[model samples]
Target: MSPTILAAILSVGVSAIATEVDSPQTQASIAVPANPDNETFAPLTPIAQIPDNSGDSSDKILEQINHYSNEPNALDQVTNVSQLRDVSPGDWAYEALRSLVERYGCIAGYPDGTYRGNRAMTRYEFAAGLNACLQQIERLIAGTNGVDGGDLETLQRLIQEFEAELATLGARVDNLEGRVAFLEDNQFSTTTKLSGEVIFGLAGVAAGEDVNGDDIDNVTIFGHRTRLELNTSFTGEDVLRTRLQAEGLGSLTEQTITPEGDLFFAGATDSDVVVDALLYDFPLGENTRVVLDANAGASDDFASTVNPFLDGDGGSGALSRFGTRHSIYYYLDGAGIGINHAFGDKLELSAGYLASEAADPGDDTGIFNGPYGALAQILFKPSDRLNIGLTYIHAYNRDTDTGSQLSNFRSFTEDAIGNAVPTSSNSYGVELSWQLSDRFALGGWVGYTQTTTLSTLGGQIDRGDLDIWNWAVSLAFPDLGKEGNVAGILVGMEPKVTDSSVNIPGIDTEDEDTSLHIEAFYQYQLTDNIAITPGIIWLTAPDHDNDNEDIVIGAIRTTFSF
Candidate 1:
């Protein structure tokens, strides 16, 4: 008989004998040996006191069992009883354990060859051990080898009991496979994403006069603009962005001769699609990144403008161009390269160069020889609520007008001789914004430009050198009417000809006055991806002389984005 069977029979007999001796009804029928030492039988410990041998201690053994179970045909190389460190001749269950290891080939020991036998066993450990033994029994049965009939019957019963649970697990796995297949079939491009936006604007003007001093009869107009962007990434870290845009919006500056700067989204006069911008940016290291603009716009390659409340593209914040950022940002408008380096999250430096005629290769019009604008800015975020930027721009033969009323002053100086003369200028500006609280924010900017005409239009006609100054303060209330809503008011001087010395021979020409530009706007987010903004711009003294009627430009803008 196997040692396991022997131990089981002996254990059952001892328990019965002990129970009978302790029973009140049968105690008198039992007798104690006169001299216990003289008996040949060995004393047996209680079954509860016999150490449990299958729980955490069997973890290493279970791992090997799982491996062999997964590959049932794998060869079992362990064959000797002495291979295990803890299994020895003196062990009470050594014979049974050895038989299981050497004959059935189901048992495994720890990496160090130790067989821990005193640890408690859990039900899962018992199941794993039984499964290994069953596989060995099945091999013997299939080969018509010496396999016990009772062992085969027990294995068959256990398999039948677990049939329902096994079926449920298989069903769950099949469901997961279906879900994965569906996702793989319906997914979009792996490396590219698309986004788009459309804007509709209704605008009108009132109480504005022309340069001829006649009351300007401005008509109300409606316009629309649309944009679609595709963002592609190859390395997962770098991005290539391409944008397509179409617009039928008339120039906001076209209604008035005074050069009240253009709207932020006003450009195309026809509803023709064009490539608005294309840019590629990649990281150089942890803190630096380089940007290449195939067709860059003014704001494409700059760091934070420090005025988040009024910087959206006429969809959020203020609707006018001047209200978005300082005019110096408008100096660049074409292809360029930019570099930005961050000093932690609180500070950053950005620099870039852009040429208006970058694609042209004619005499004075190429990327290198054409009218080019170079900009450098240092941005600081002292706190989560405060941002500041110090900017400097140097442009050669570039137009300094940005549709704001101040642009009129700059344009007037350039057109002094009945022809526009190219000018070179160095502009310096400081912008700051502070979110004082959850509901309110304050922002402002001060800009100065020193311009020198480059044309040799003779002595008296030469406009010589000019100095322009512009500044504004803005007050904004976030979530004013509802969540995702904003209201803002801006008041500042338009670029003014603070000092100009045009040597017109006998006539001394200079602008001695500055105009005030006041604007107010409210943006209401109608949905997660849609917004409506109504705004009004009031220019006091459209001309430095204050002779022109106060200009009021009002517009209602609607935007949809996805």
Candidate 2:
């Protein structure tokens, strides 16, 4: 009846309006170059310019046809196609009927193109259209429920499963959002201090065995101890300050490894890794601040020749088992740079890079090797009373090539085992500290390492693999006396966790055992620019058989700061 209904009834309205009405040539003929970037490309041809007739139809049918006509391709109905035979209105009718034939295959074309539109009274053609409609209706009915009549049921089920999974994922995201909000609402802050002590001591002992049935006077030169440490900060920003110290440098040969063992040094020897000072900070929005003295020239652990690694309290005043720390070297020289920053005080971050040069070893050049190293650290203070920090260090030493000159220090009979063993190594450390009050504090540390070679032979031979581990704990008590006096005690033990052996045949690869460390200290003000410090330490490590092995030393030190 109407143009729109006629097209849909034949199903030709959908296809002809889409392709024939939206022609590129028609649009280009009326085009102005206004919105070129988003313009759609379409086929350009004179046949695509046909106009649609404005006729009446059922409102639904008319609306659908107009919508299809506005799409990309619509107007290229009859003239847009190329054919061997001439096409007329009858050809358009035949092509419209072909859409149903292609999908359902229910009808066959006549032997000649006559009576196709006007005389379609044949039962066979009518039956074919009925068959096509019945087939499409049956397929639609089967697809109405959860399943399909064809094998496409599997595809439908898969789509449903995907939708369920998407809903579950959305629920999980909502739960995580609630948890994150709760954590951000309850965040708090913590503060902590970073401090440590390194002591080096030297004292005389005898050749006979002590009451403990161990060697008393195998007297040897040793680095009684060394310590590096930092002060704690918890203020929601980056802050860095450090005080490094080394003591007991002048008195090296003072302890016995065995009863009659030869002396490690004829007398006092040189110290290698001395103390240096670095102070750095970041003031709110200001740049990082640093105050370092390559040569502070103070005295004692912080200075040179005037104050050695030891503090002169060696004999009867040695520290008990309750107050000792690991040993370190004094008179040693090194230079370093430090950085400190804080992201709001709870997460404190600090790092340092240090390099220590070789000190001139006196007569026994082989014993005093050249060592270089780097150090870095990060600390976290989540509350005002507790602090945690981690430290990383790397060190390297050149092979001491002149072994013959230091024969008196340590003796070795090479079952071909002794030689120059240059090594490079890294150490990692973690510390936890707590301040109980203004007058008391406690802390501990654990560190592991696969360090440089602990030499056996002279500087000529090397045994590459030597691993080590270190650990400790300590407590400090302050304000024991008047305003100027202070006291503290510390005790810790570090046991070796490695089979202390090198690749050598017929040589006894002694099990590297753990060493026990202890220290005690008391400080009194002597003057405005000076303080007197008396301290003692005891160190013990077992032999390969787990026997008692120990060394005891003491010292007195004076410090000045400006």
Candidate 3:
């Protein structure tokens, strides 16, 4: 008979197509990047996640072919599924499908030879394939001496048998095509995905003392921080992230004269928007990923902070910055580059360098001449439930951004020794996380830094050394009250000067005695796009000095994400 009718009549056509066609891919779904430390916030939920395909599917003969193809992901969709001889049925189906593809150009699989992996095959796709076959046959019929009587009869019979299905499929195809067109015309940007977060907090000092030995005022204030991120991917594997941030949340530590209670969500920008982060990230080879920072890029952007569940880039994680991870990480900030390489699944190495004045070209204001931090970390995952990391940072004039002034004042001993002497430090840290169960997790870190006076302006004080230390442990309860809720408790010591040969002239000379930090927070996810957290932080000795009055802070924060 006719070539068109003959192909379908053969046992190969319906069965082979069903069995060989890779799962029809979904043109409907869009990809969202990763977590807060990566790109978008709120792990894979509604606005922060890819949408689901709404296509109707079934196990009918044609659908069976699609089922096999859908297993491979978008990245694997381009893989060539050429003539595979290892499986006899696969080999036969490949040859048969290839013939129909070349002869009629029907169901043109993929240009790269992979069947339309996971891209759903709609009635439109089927009708297009069918039309190609019918059109080719029509051209042949119009040719001289095209078909014999037997062939003509066979084709007519087959057409009469499937006429109803053909018409229905054609009408459905037209409708679907129109809908797809309208969506394409109305959808958001083809290359970029948008995500955003807004946090409103009512925070204040419940009790405390100022460093000047004055009773701290119990002032309460309401503030906010907002972030909007546009993540664009030129290539499937790389992403360029641009973030807009605005914050006016004031810190409770300002009233206590200690940095221990600095709220993670607080930033005193007075509601002024800024391009807070601009980073371009791409895969280097197979295992390495490189991050280029054009603006505010922190070490955790690429490097593993090793604190899971509680490492939400200060937006969704701990209430205080010190509870997020080891305070040593505070040194790795500013505009810089970060690189991560995976040795395998179990181990990874991350390194980076950041300079506060990288964008400045004025005298003594260039990258290397300004405050900077160089960091290296090795992370080991012994099991799915356990992770350990060892980190080191060599920095010049880098402050412990989240701790007390003894830790925060790294730029100079100028305030203390009267001379603006430069300082450098070497910081070491160890981090660990263990998942005790699906609901319980424990994480903590310890950091130590040795600071050395680099030079003196007037040689008024002998250049000596200072030793600083900080430690913390956190326990997390996941899905505590609800499926998306978390209850966290953290206890730690803020960065304090344990010893210093070089002395300060006016201040407490050094933070004396041990200061304990106790914090607890419960995050209740009200909806996929919203969460509320009420937390309390208590500092027994503000600024690590026992003489200072104890500080207690409370905050209720609400976050909306999209």
Among the numbered candidates, top lDDT falls to 3
* lDDT (10s digit) by residue, model 3, range 15-79: 11222222146321111111123222221122113222223232252343233335343322212
Query: What's the C-alpha lDDT at position 82 in model 2?
Result: 23
> Model 1 lDDT vs. the true structure?
0.66
Cα miss at 272, model 1 (Å)?
1.3
The TM-score obtained by model 3 is 0.77
Q: What's the true lDDT of residue 335 in model 2?
A: 49
lDDT at position 90, candidate 3: 29
In model 2, which regions exceed 4 Å deviation? Answer: 1-249, 257-287, 290-333, 358-371, 398-419, 452-464, 494-497, 505-513, 525-532, 541-550, 556-562
Q: What is the descending lDDT order?
A: 3, 1, 2
Per-candidate Cα lDDT values, in order, are 0.66, 0.38, 0.69
Error of 1 at 409 (Å): 7.3
The regions of model 1 sitting more than 4 angstroms off are 1-184, 403-416, 504-509
Q: Could you give candidate 1's per-residue lDDT for residues 1-562 as a string of tens digits? A: 1223222222322111110111112211101112213222232222224343333333454443333334222122246758866666766555545555555655554445554454343323233334434556666668856666554554454445433323333443466589878877986677898899999988878677754467767788888899999999999899998999999788756667655544677767798999988999899999999888888556545566778899985557777777888877877778888899999989999999988889997898989898888989998989999999999999887755553332333355455545455678899999999999999999999999887877655543665677777899999999997999999999987677677664554533445555678889888999999999988988876755566677788888899999
**Model 2 lDDT on a 0 to 1 scale:** 0.38
Per-candidate RMSD vs. true structure?
16.0, 27.6, 10.6
lDDT of 3 at 538: 89
